[model samples]
Target: MNYRTHIVSDLSEIGQAGWDGLVRAQDKPNPFLSYAFLHALHESGSAAPQTGWQPQYLVLFDGEELAAALPLYVKDHSYGEYVFDWAWADAYQRHGLDYYPKLLSAIPFTPVSGPRLMARDAHARAALVDVLVATQQATEVSSTHLLFPPEEQARQLKEAGFLLRSGVQFHWLNGGYANFEEFLATLEQKKRKNIRAERRKVAQAGVTLRRVRGREATHADWVLFNRCYRNTYRAHHSTPYLNLDFFERIGRDMPDNILLVIAEREGRPIAASLVIHDETTLYGRYWGELEHVPCLHFEAAYYQPLEFCIEQKIAVFEGGAQGEHKMARGFLPTRTWSAHWLAHPSFADAVERFLERESGGIDDYLDELNERTPFRK
Candidate 1:
């Protein structure tokens, strides 16, 4: 039981083989769980201290064999985390307490649920939590939060003394569909027609979409994707978190998980959506269009992904976070959990109370979502 803990201050310090080994054994396989994915975030400057996401990765070793690791960050602000804690921070501000410099265990900007704590065995997983709990106490940070953790890991963290928080995300699951039409068959007839109309608009607009995987994605592809990606943010007057180099790097290093659907008209790439997949599921990450075509977003983002999942026989497709628009496309409401540890006793009590009320609201919201599903009776 001799073990030592190493603080991974930089991405280079964490090796992919050692990290991936632990992750492969997990109950759920989320592409975001890969070390390469998180490393890309730091290496590409998307999740660095300069960007307010200081990596404080924790690694455990039992006499030279890497046992477990957590992709932890000492966050100054919660900008990209899908789990909203702005109000929590504001409450602490009102009470004259600092909430910055909190610890987070997550896949940086991605909100897809997967393993947060990686371990070779159950013992290692439990030990990892112990180490994290100790780190939280010793650092005297405001709190430590693990966002979008898989269900088993969430339960394990709860057993290790972290407060459980719940949220909902819309995900499309494959129901043994032979094709996209079979998938639509489960949906209400009106919803089916709506999806068909959306897909038809792209073809009517003379836009044909093509999907390019990893190494197959070229410089021109990156340029087109970034242009579309940035335009989407710019239209909203915000900047993108990822850079062109990051996309290029991931395309080179991790091609199996990267899928880019590009809509082309007159031999020019117009709208593009980026998706990542593993053995189990496809994650619809980002997309934007240079030219606004009617229902083009739905075709490029939702319909294309749904078709791919059905064709590939992938188990699920997570459409990122917070999209009621996804319901009409057959993406159902699924619960996501995060664990929080607060340092201040008074603030902790206050947050716990607030969470109790928020949880009720979330439950009611999920019920409404289910009731509004476009699925046939």
Candidate 2:
């Protein structure tokens, strides 16, 4: 088998078919991890050099066949990645070493957990990692990190000498629910009442929710969506990772993977939630509201998406990123993984030390979260 790596400086080199074909055949496929999805992010300017996520996608080829690929970036700052490394960056600063322009393998602005190392088989997967190590060394990047990979992939990376780091994100899994009521029944009485009241508030306020898909959704829909999208960032006193152009391009190019739940009052959109669905799971992505309607966030982000999942027979709903409040709505804590390789010996030593201590605290926290499960035991 012959091997080569592309800089991913141009979109054409990482052809959509070559990447999507591998994704479709994988056991646990996710649209967020697809070529079309990542490319749309770049082409639409959501994840670009200007936004600190410059494409440095790595691809491995064998003869005329595509063997493996990774979505990588030449990062200047860590804004979109949920995993915080600011302290490490500060440590690099204290030591007068550069951390910017390091190598990263992750879905830009996405914190959802799934596969990162894509390949036809284990041998190829392992070989791909070896290639990335050599590439990073040759390029003299400070380090390379793969965030939120599946457990097996993380283990293999650890075997290849990358230090393993663990984190938790909450997700809701369906367990033979005949309907949403059956799901709500699993929650404790107090929590169940709280959720019911939230949903009820939306209906009482004369708000109706509708879902729009892909090409069917209009540019006006995207325009309204971005307005709501920016509200969340503004509330937090920060800027949103994506812009209107990015949202518009994605909706045009990849409608099959997109799901928008629009909440309207008297036929006008007041709140919206944007989600992505593949074969098995629905990922709850960005959401916001133009109006401060009670329980609007839950109705748009959680209840609405959960209803769509059940109607479509999708197995799981991964509420994006961290939200302990998700527990009250039936989402449970699940372990997530990342693999790190730091070039500076002292910084590497300190990070590994911190990770060792952090893992214990994380384990205990997961145990505590599991003990408080909303589902009936």
Candidate 3:
């Protein structure tokens, strides 16, 4: 049994068909994994080496068919990865070791959990895992990390000698809600009242919200969304990881999977949120507002998308990254996983010990979060 390998710097190196075919074969395929979306990230220079995310896509072929593929990158910094490792990097830095240029497999800037290793079967996936380790060793990076991979892949990575780290994000699950009101009705009275109050605040503030599908989103709309996206980052005093070009590319290339919620005041768009969705799930990606309105963020980012989810029967809406506040808005805490492999023995042991303790803390945290569910019993 022989398998061919391709160290793809450009996604087109393996072609869209092969790459997407592998993604489709995976039990969970999302828009972010689709070739168009990833290619856009590369061609637009959003995730380029110059910007710290140098694409190092890995693939394996079995007699002219793609057996496995990993959306790998040589990351110089841990900026876009949602799974934070700044402490680990700092530990290495204090000890005079390089932590940059680490091997990473994740959708850059996107933290929604799903498959990172796209493979036809378990065998191919296992091979991909082995290849990932080989590539890490060959590259001589400090560590190899796969972020937001599903439990199964995380386990596979752990089985192959990787440290598993856990984090939590808020996700709203659909309950066959025929309407937004029906969904809200299931929540505790106080929670339901709070949601209505928030929505009413937006309404009273004369902030009208509209949802635009990507196909219907014009260049002007992209510009508006970009303005809001940048504003959000600026408010945080941080640089926006993605650019207007990346947004436009995805809007052009993967229109069906996009939803842009824009807030209007005096019939002028002031805020916008970008969300990615498939048949069953919606990912809350990015948002920004030019003018702040009370509850406008919730209206544009959370409530509007939840309405879309209810209407479309989308089962899950992942509010990206840490937002314990989301639980108040009906988004419950959910556990997210990342697997890591460190080359340095002492550092690896230290990280392993730390993760063991962290995992237990996460377990307790989840229990506490579950006890605080906003729904009526």
User: What TM-score quantifies how close candidate 2 is to the native fold?
Assistant: 0.96
**What's model 2's overall lDDT?**
0.85
Q: Pick the candidate with the highest TM-score.
A: 3
Per-residue lDDT of candidate 3, residues 16-87 (tens digit):
888888888888788999998888888888889888888888889999999988888988899988788999
Off by over 4 Å in 1: none
Clashes of each: 0, 0, 0
Ordering by lDDT: 3, 1, 2
How do the residues 1-377 of candidate 2 rate in per-residue lDDT, one tens digit apiece? 55765556755675778778878766586878776778778877888888878887777778767787777899988888888888888888888989887888888888988778888888778888888888877886778889999999999988887899999898889876778898888888988899999999889999999989886899899999999999878988988888888888778778898999999999888989999987688898999888888889899999988988877788889988999999999998999999999887888898999999999999999999988988666
The predicted structure with the larger TM-score, 1 or 3, is 3
**Candidate 1 local lDDT, 1-377, one digit each (tens):** 75699999885665777777777887786777776777788888988999999988999999878898888999899989999899989988997989998999988878988778888888888888899988999996899999998878888888877888999999998998998888888999999998888888779889998878776899999988999999989988987899887888788788988889999999888899999998779998989889888988888888888888888889989898998888988999999999998988887887888889988999999999988988999
Instruction: Point out where model 2 deviates above 4 Å.
Output: none
Count clashing pairs, candidate 3.
Answer: 0
Measured by lDDT, the strongest candidate is 3
lDDT of 3 at 25: 84
